[model samples]
Target: MLSDYFPSVGGQRAPDAELGATLRDFVAQQQGPISAHLRHRHTQTNEIGRCVALWPVLAHIAQESGGAALALLDVGSSAGLNLGVDAYTLCYHCGGASVHVGGAPRTDCRCCVASCVGSAARSMGCANLPVAGALSHRLGLDPMPVDVRDTDATRWLQACVWPCDLVRQQRLALALELARQHGWQVKQTGPSCIEAIHAWLDGLPSAVQPVVLNSWVLCYFSEQERARHEQAMIDLVRQRGVVWVSAETPSLRPTDMALPATPPHDSKGATLWCQVSHHAGEVRQRALAWSHPHGAWLQWLG
Candidate 1:
């Protein structure tokens, strides 16, 4: 269904065609580190430039909620390693053989083309800003989380990574270690994960704004499941919560960005870091992105 909707990695169902023969072999083997390395290697995220692009909008969520202490959730958060985004002071290591991290978020301005959804998100009045402070509170949720601590799980995580990019693998390792150092753990378990999240939400003192984001989750869901989960989200929204979700377009119908709309395919270059606040069925979208990561450009599609 995802392939029918939009182009997946290389748009090929088979392994060799998408990432090459090595990946196909690795996936079939299903070894531990190899899977993780493959996943980290090919599945993006190591592109710190892209992730940092929307720091500010995320920061805005913090400001709106209260401070650096708002609950953050990442749906389909593979290894759940990136959930510890706050621990590492990200630095873009692009155009280099090794990851060139920085002690802090880069301070530079860059340009990016807005996606159709991004344009609409801007129309909704979202503003992007660099926010190290807000990132401190981010968290994650994934169905088959890669157990970074378990040797086998780590191996599986690496194996799923694209076979070619060792840099990505190393970057993931570093990020996982950093997250672990911070006492942030991602669990591998049941449907109650959502329930646990709701419980966490319920536990919050309400002084902070609770935000839920599930980027690229629709691809994994069947039509029925998508309907059910989306309804759940709607119920959450009705309860006055904030949700940040973006799925590749061609995979979904193009509609108002304010409503539950699929993002456009080929909408590259820019990201929509929007905040939605609905008023009597009328919602406003906030478009924001960091624009740059210490000189290197980034695409933050929050």
Candidate 2:
């Protein structure tokens, strides 16, 4: 149905009037199917483009650990495409300079692009950014996990993407294919991200540093839930020595968390990238960067 309506997915391009009429007619004819879909499906976009923003942060983590193996746990990971972050090629443009990471020759990986914005763009050096190494283990936790191998689920993921955004559609296709080839594990867990963390953290190998990550997921939780999630993350950091990385709206972030010295020029429509960790007895949170919700651009604060 999506492919039939959107030209980007091989649908015929129609005039505005024709398109509206056709959509209305289709909806009228497919009322039952549409109703069933609406009742069961949730907006679960697995935006692989966000991996561009994640790459540098993971690299920084690896560098901090002296290149030790790291395990990744992604909360609300729909189809777990971003788990294969190291499998894609990330191209970043900053201050008229560019840097590429991941995807060796003959890999046939899709390229995800991003740019550095604002004052940070001028000072940021592509040379100093650490390269993200291979992840030791990648696990995803979601209340309702989408399986990339499932035809219906995969189609729904495609539908979640904006019809006009052909670039994102292509990226998602390539990412889905990569996910199928890799067969990353995504466990169906409870609704609370905190519960998922507690359930999975103890099972990871002690030798590998655990990095719990979530992108644009905390907003789904209530203010109280968010606070509990934050406290849980801090507890994990203090007791289990894990790192928490988040890419969410600033307003959604815990009030107790530290703010960046220089905030983004425009916070509206921007996602805040943060890293929370505990060393000794104190817990610290640092706002790493501010980025587009879909990784179009990033303003570094680290």
Candidate 3:
């Protein structure tokens, strides 16, 4: 279906008139199937481009932990593609200075290049970015987990991408291939994300540190639910020594988390990267950077 409509997937341009007619005819013939699919599946982009913004934060956490192996728990992980964060290469270019992370060779890797902006870009250099460390385990929590092994599930994941986004489509394909090779694990979660985290925490090895990650997920929750989730993160940091990494909108930031003196000028549609941890018995929250929702660029704040 995608191949018939999208030129990037089809290898030939489809005339606008024919495209509309074909779609209408197809919909009329397959109304039942289309409706069933829409009713059962939610849009799950599973964008791996987010890893460009995420790698720096993960590296920061690893460095703070004395290079301890991390056990990643990704909430709302669509196909668990971002679980292969350690496998891709990230190249950051800020004011003519460039830095690279990940073990994959440039040619054979799912490589992403991001630019930096704002006054903070002046001091940004290679030394400022921490090298990512090892991952002891990877797990995802989603109400409906997409299995890469399932043809229908993977196809639905592809259909979720915008037809015009060729770059993202190619990147997603690479990430899906990597996921199939790695066999990432995704567990079904109940209504409470905090409860799901608690269950997974007990099962992790003591030597590895637990890092909970959520990107653009809290927006789906109600106001009360968002507040509850924020409070739960603070409590987890103080009690269980867990770290919470979030990439969400500025409006969704926790009440106690201090904002930067001068927020990013281009923050209108940007995602705020943040880390919540405990230091000297106090729950500390730091705003790390401002980035494009799909990580096209980043403005380093910390």
Candidate 4:
């Protein structure tokens, strides 16, 4: 993101001619040790596109979970932007052919376009798609959660967007604005986010169904750590019903995990979307779609 946001790096076209070289130079010139900054900084790409792919699935789970308010636990939530999904509008362009629109919640600002819910539902092929209920408890768990209110932290969040993608940049700005308006609570997940899940869920009222979301987080963990986190989710289901949503690369998935169809990729890579349900003593996992990591578009597998 730095390469895109930093004036020195992105201002001149020549320096950005080769992305690898431009980043290397930028890192070398910084006064402090790069390692320390990397250790502390987390790319909280609270991507809106991801929500396009995820919202439908969330709606499905919410309906199945008795339609009460949710206690959302976001694992590896950098600035917890994803937690603000309900607050912003979503526009989905499928196959670069069809445009489906989804509305944001009611906002008082005049400049803010009142989000409406017609086209978005039509595009997803769900007539009565349920938007998530009021969040009784929204908690983000990250080793390094960015405080979106902080200027530096906010800039870092913007910097995480890809260079030259004006649409995504605008979406990021909107998501951040919504996050600022709605206060989101982020807690440290400690050494393992999986281990910390139980405590967070236990604290919420039983009426509020628990929904745990992780987007491209486990890839950062070692194989053993990944296994531990997966096991933790399974245990959460066996003990008490919960919904686990994940967006991950295929390689990080278990061998038994199935994709709705073979994944397609762009210049970036593949991101497979999945939803796991533990309802009525039955644990079920379904592959929903293949999408761009940041949710640029999605090909629904159903």
lDDT-superior candidate, 1 or 2: 2
**Candidate 2 minimal-lDDT segment of 10 residues:** 102-111
Ranking by lDDT: 3, 2, 4, 1
Q: Return the top candidate by TM-score.
A: 2
Better of 2 and 4 by TM-score: 2
| Backbone clashes counted, model 3 | 0
Give the least accurate 10-residue stretch of model 1, judged by summed lDDT: 115-124
Q: For all candidates, what are the clash counts?
A: 34, 0, 0, 2
Best by lDDT: 3
Query: Per-residue alpha-carbon lDDT of model 4 for 1-302, expressed as tens digits?
Result: 34464442445343455678757787888747667768877656666567666666666566667688877888988878777666555554333333222233211111101221212232333223457666678888998777878888878778787756766676677667767777788887677886678788778887888888888888778888888888878778667787777778866654357645454345256677777767557777777656667665555553
In candidate 1, which residue ranges exceed 4 Å CA deviation? 1-50, 65-68, 92-128, 132-138, 189-193, 245-275, 279-282, 285-302
The runs of at least 3 residues in candidate 2 whose Cα sits more than 4 Å from the true structure, single-residue gaps closed, are 1-5, 12-15, 98-125, 258-267
What local distance difference test score does each model get?
A: 0.46, 0.74, 0.75, 0.66
Per-prediction TM-score to the true structure, in the order listed? 0.60, 0.85, 0.83, 0.76
What's the lDDT of the predicted structure labeled candidate 3? Answer: 0.75
Over 207-262, each residue of candidate 1 has an lDDT whose tens digit, in order, gives: 55666665444556677766666556555666656544432223331124443222
lDDT of 3 by residue, 1-302 (tens): 42565745764565566777777888898999999998987877787778777877788788889999998999988788788887776656545544333221122112234422111122324445666678888899987788888889888888888877777777777777778877889888877668889988999888998899988888888899888888888888889989999888887776777766434344466788889988887888898766777777665565
Better of 1 and 4 by lDDT: 4
